[model samples]
Target: MYSHLLIPIDGSPLSMGAMQTAMAFARDAGAEVTVLTVVEPFHIFTVSPEQLQAKRGEYERQARAHAADLLAAAEREAKLLGVRCEVVQVESDDPYLVIVETASKRGCDLIAMASHGRRGIAALLLGSVTLKVLTHSKVPVLVYR
Candidate 1:
């Protein structure tokens, strides 16, 4: 049985669904869950420092706010399920790597997340963070598709 579970979410319907499922699983196992939301740094090709500064600041604010909202909702749900929960937010260009590292650092026995179910060219272009986490993480991953 898992003593701790790490659930990474992107605020998507799929990820939210997975989070709910993982929360239930954690409650059943008498395990706590850490809900993680990784906000990617804003990327832009602006030569003007003023524009870059302003836009990047705005993006950062919005991203963190959204992450906060998501985490709050998750916390409420966890409370309703009577499961202990911890929430974390971080900025990283590589969210998948962050997820793996956080799982290890938090001593999580399992990493549960949703898969986007990408295929072929679309997957190649957009890339799949879930796939990367599965490939790179040493912790066991439970993928919800």
Candidate 2:
């Protein structure tokens, strides 16, 4: 019953598992999948002006490249399944916000993402992005742990 599916990837194995789940759903529904990856914004306030500029530029470039690679992989998988798909790369410090915004902007009906399965101090330190997305996203979310 879903029209558009949004799958967020971070190049992690956990994220890949979520992608597989999204793929299965897409296959069943004959829905188009939009794969999104957010490249975090580079923080520059703490560094010298020159350093900030260089670091920011480098981070942007790396992010773009990484996103491209991930998108390509996702496309390959989708093509194999004979499914229509789109890839979107976003830049933001808050990946959850970016994911939700992109899903809304792209008119996705569902979001599929992986949980890192963090616990205790590790969870506190890392502050789960999946948790944020689950808590805030307006669309239906299918989290793959």
Candidate 3:
């Protein structure tokens, strides 16, 4: 009987699927949903200040556009399900931290997201955001595979 459910998505197929699944659950529970998309800041290894200045602006601009498109699509999905929806976009290097903080700040009763199955080296490189959220979140977390 959650009043507000937080769904975090990254536009991956698994995350999108989790969004759909959680939206259905929200509809059934008569709970409003908040869809969050967190964009990690772009990393650059170059030493040129000019390159850094130029590329950082472009990277953020595109990331913002992409997040907007992704959130808009999610809003449409929620509308189709007749579930009240709000969308949030955040930029951070630590996505799991952002997700947890957003859930607490928004007063979301639950955090639902996909368990992106990255293994070994890939997991190490990308970091298991879902696991981090599970470990750190005070709110309940529902993970969909």
Candidate 4:
């Protein structure tokens, strides 16, 4: 039933696993794929405006480049299955919110993402972005671990 699928990738091996799963699903369902990458915003409280500007720009550039590469790779895989695909990069400090919002705005029916598999102290301190997404998202989410 999912026609427009949103796949959020962070260029990690875990996320790559999710991408593969999403690609397979899309191929079977004849759905279009929307690959999204989010770049966290600058921390204004920690850094000055000027400093944040340069650092944010650098990070954004790197994030965009990485997203482009990921999208390209995913696109190649989708092409082999003869499926349609599109790529988008979003800038936001709240990755979960951005992913949810983008999926809603794009009319995606489902979100397919990879879990980093964080646990214990790391998960507590860093928190789970995928968890936040699952909690906040109104649409269906298929998490790939």
Candidate 5:
């Protein structure tokens, strides 16, 4: 019943699987897809202020390029499936916030994402963005593990 789907990609194999799943779902539902890739802002606390400022631009550029490439692949796959796709790249320290905001702002009816299935200490330390999105997003979330 979803007319618009939002899919977040991290360029991992699991994320790719989610992309494929979302594509098929979108095709079947006759829905448009919005592919989002969030890039983490660069942080180097050890560096001096000047050094950090100098390197920030380059770091951000590289990150944006990587995100764009990831979104491009998703777009291509969705196009092949005859699904309309839009790509978004955002730079944020809190990806979950960006994901939720983008979903709401874009008027997506559903968010389809992949969970890394991290558990125990790893999950505690790194934290799961998908989990955060599910917790915070107002829109419906469809997580593919």
Candidate 6:
């Protein structure tokens, strides 16, 4: 019953599976898809201004390139499924915030993403983005392991 689906990808194998599942669901529901990849902002202390600027530029370039590659593959998959798709790449320190905000801004009814399945201390240390998104997002979330 969803009209628009938002799928977040991190280039992980699990995320790829989520993408496939989301695409199939979108095709079945005649829904368009929006794929999002959030790149973390580069930050470092104890660096000269010039060095900091150079490093920041380099980091952004590399991150955008990686996001583009990931989004391209998703786009190709959507095309194969005959589903309309759009791609978004954003820089944010908090990916969950970006995912939630993008879903709201794009008017998506559903969010489909993969959980890294981290648990216990690892989950506490590495903070699951999927969990955060589920907690914070108003849109319906369908998570795939």
Cα deviation in Å at residue 18, candidate 5? 0.6
| Candidates ranked, most accurate by TM-score first | 1, 3, 6, 5, 2, 4
lDDT of 2 by residue, 13-106 (tens): 7787778778878989989999998876677663324336566677678768878998999998899888899998888767889889989999
| Model 5 whole-model lDDT (C-alpha atoms) | 0.85
Residue-level lDDT tens digits of model 6 in 49-143: 43376677887787788889999999999999999999999988788999999999999999999986323353577688888999999999999
RMSD of 6: 4.4
**What ranking emerges by lDDT with the best candidate at the front?**
1, 3, 6, 5, 2, 4
Query: Residue-wise lDDT of candidate 3 within 69-94, one digit each (tens)?
Result: 98998999999999999999999878
* Model 5 CA deviation exceeding 4 Å by range: 46-54, 117-123
lDDT score for candidate 3 against the true structure: 0.88
* Steric clashes per prediction: 0, 0, 0, 0, 0, 0
lDDT score of model 1?
0.88
**Candidate 2 vs 6: which has more lDDT:** 6
TM-score between model 5 and native: 0.86
Across 49-109, the per-residue lDDT of candidate 1 in tens digits comes to 4336667778778889999999998999899999999999999978889999999999999
Backbone clashes in model 6, listed as residue pairs = none
User: What TM-scores do the predictions have?
Assistant: 0.88, 0.83, 0.88, 0.82, 0.86, 0.86
For all candidates in order, the CA lDDT equals 0.88, 0.82, 0.88, 0.81, 0.85, 0.87
Question: Which should have the higher lDDT, number 5 or number 6?
Answer: 6
**Model 1 misplacement above 4 A:** 46-54, 117-123
Model 2 TM: 0.83
lDDT for each residue of candidate 4 in 1-145, tens digit (9 for 90 to 100): 8899999887788888798889899989989989887755556464334335566677657657766888888888788878798888777767789889989999999999987632335457768889988989999999998
Query: Where does the lowest 10-residue lDDT sum fall in candidate 4?
Result: 44-53
